[model samples]
Target: MKTADCDILILPGLAGSEEDHWQARWASRLPTARIVVQDDWHAPEPEAWRRRIAEAVAAARRPVILIAHSLGVVAAVEAAPDFPPDVVRGALLVALPDVEEAPDLPDSVRAFAPLPRDPLPFPSLLVASRTDPHCAYARAEDFAYAWGAQIVDAGDSGHINVASGHGPWPEGLMRLAGFLKTL
Candidate 1:
């Protein structure tokens, strides 16, 4: 589906996507896109995050497409089942953090552990980094397989965040456009 034909929901990870983050930049560029704000970015609550995503999808006037990063990927997938069926056309999941096994994640992030393995209800693509400090590449592969999402390997891209020098991330926009075409 064309971006103009759908509501693009941006879901940022812990601490939220900064102004220079790719998600924020994409939001500024995409007219139909908007960020789903959480109550607490520093300390996320799984149920709250899930409910917010579901509500965002439900409130959308057009078919939805999710663009989630890091821990937001976990929230989006966890809430996928709760979304209005058939309303969400697809999702672009990026930098999925290994909450279940990553050793350095904060205690707050671990609340989203035991990541949902059930296949997502809608078509989805997961963009994984080979050198993300938060998650192992192999584990990301496992997540994609479990979620029934097509995996895209991003070579040595550290977390694919602003800190990783992905401020504009035009490549990601191209990828999203390509994924949109498939839907």
Candidate 2:
């Protein structure tokens, strides 16, 4: 489906995508996009994050498409069943952190470690880098397979975050656009 035909929700990671983050830029560029605002970006709570997404999806007036990154990806998965499957068509899930051994993360994120590996009900894509500081490619592939999502190898994108020099994230936007076009 075309972007204008769908309500695209942009979900950001842990501390929420900063101003310079790619997700932010993408949201600004897309007329139909809106960010899933969490109560607290500094200290995330999985349940709260999940609830916000569920409510957004439930209230959407048009066909919904999720464009999510990092912890936002986790929130989306946890809240997926809460949304009417027919309403939200698909998702572009990106940068899954290695929940297995993420000790340095904040308490909010640490609580989500060893996340559920269940398959997603709707069509989706999982984008990961080969040398991401947050997760290894092998684990990412494993999660993608378990989640039943097609994996997109993003090379050494370094968690695909703002700190990694993805200010504009034009390339990532192109990839996301390509994925949206397919839907």
TM-score of each: 0.99, 0.95
Instruction: Report the C-alpha lDDT of model 1 over 57-166, residue by residue, as the tens digit.
Output: 99999999999999999999999889887999999999999998999999889988889899999899999999999999999999899999999999999999999999
Lowest-scoring 10 consecutive residues by lDDT in candidate 2?
Answer: 99-108
Q: Highest TM-score: which candidate?
A: 1
Judged by lDDT, which candidate is best? 1
Residues 1-183 of candidate 2 have per-residue lDDT tens digits of 888999999999888888888889888989999999999988888788889999999999999999999989888988987898688888998888876665456666877766778888888999998878778899888888998999999998888887777788788778777887787
TM-score of 2: 0.95
- Structure candidate 2, residue pairs in collision: 1-183
Clash numbers, per candidate: 0, 1
Q: Could you tell me the lDDT of residue 142 within candidate 1?
A: 94
User: Residue 36 deviation, candidate 2, in Å?
Assistant: 0.7
Stretches of candidate 2 off by over 4 Å are: none
In model 1, which regions exceed 4 Å deviation? none
Question: Model 1's lDDT to the true fold?
Answer: 0.95
